[model samples]
Target: MNIIPILASAGITGFESPAAEYSQLGCNLDELLIEHPSATFIGKACGDSMQGVGIFDGDLLIVDRHVTPTHQDVIVANFNGEFVCKLLDIKRRLLLSANEKIQPVVINDFDTFSIEGVVIRSIRCHRPSPLLSNK
Candidate 1:
């Protein structure tokens, strides 16, 4: 979906005041967030394994297949035929877990270990919905 650009300021502030004139901020969120929509897929974070990196359980991950996997990039990869998300160490060829308790996964073979996509963005809902929340 195409997003309409909103008139907003770029600077971060503790207080917000009424704008004198409404004008485009010269940017759109959809345009900035999404590069290739067709190749991008959404995945839900399942556990606290990535909590150190702020990726909590139930968080939505924006996976972009078009982007090239790089060093220290959070990625969804096939580890021994199982799909998992972890930090990629390209030079060392290892998958590092965010949680300190979990041991880093060393890449044995490049064939079986395949990168699905790079995690472009992460989304979390702070507020619970009325339907799901118990009063």
Candidate 2:
């Protein structure tokens, strides 16, 4: 969903070669990208506040609740009853942003905040999917 579209150019296949030994290879993406499947969930980013970190609006966020968040880790959290994505500054107890224009949010004692998960992966779509509405 950051899917870098490859510009496929036209190519020519001169002649059919003899049938050599062939094998089918299996590729499971989940095994490569996910560590904790049951504890992981995917969410879509919805704002321009984290573009500097390569997480843009409409990017698919793979958040893992089982993973412990570290300092400066990008995370999804329930901030005041709503979900938000931000950088976790544990020492300062604040939510920071990659974009300079977006101000950091301090976590006060009165605020209702809970860390939902640590953002492990994010996907961006370079082109619209055929399954989705065409623009």
Candidate 3:
């Protein structure tokens, strides 16, 4: 059997709305966005080095530790004890930036480095959001 979902625009002020007509109780953002809950984490992007890939400063990043990092994949890593987000070049042993202004970094044997996780999802806030602000 085929099931068709009805489009809805619910606007209720403390009263029971027509939401009961829907099959599911509600939609959960966590359920939709997160795949591996235990291996997932969220971080805020602090620089424009990844702006070319649409990950701007102050954007919310959802990193997943369970996934393996492939070549040219956007990833978070611990480079010389500091956490940074960059594009991984597995074969070249380099960390690349999405923005042209930023140069790619070479991973040398002397430099301590480890891939932390993959950046699976990103969220951008057009307006100032209280959740992302220090206030």
TM-scores vs. true structure, each candidate: 0.73, 0.77, 0.79
Q: Candidate order by TM-score, highest to lowest?
A: 3, 2, 1
Indicate the TM-score of model 3: 0.79
TM-score, model 1 to reference: 0.73
Point out the higher-scoring one by lDDT: 2 or 3: 3
The residue-by-residue lDDT of candidate 2 on 50-135, one tens digit each, is 99899998888999999999999999999999999999999999999999998999999999999999999999888876653324
Q: Write the per-residue lDDT of candidate 1 for residues 1-135, one digit (tens) a residue.
A: 333445556687655444433444555756677799889988878888899999998787989999999899999998888889999999998899999999988898555888999999998878755643335
RMSD of each candidate relative to the true structure:
5.0, 6.2, 6.5
The local distance difference test score of each candidate is 0.83, 0.86, 0.89
lDDT of 3 by residue, 1-135 (tens): 222355545655565544555465354778767899999999999989999999999999999999999999999999999999999999999999999999999999999999889999999888998777977
Residue 71, candidate 1: how far off, in angstroms? 0.7
Weakest ten-residue segment in model 3 by summed lDDT: 1-10
lDDT of 1: 0.83
The clash count of every prediction, one per candidate, is 0, 6, 0
Candidate topping lDDT: 3
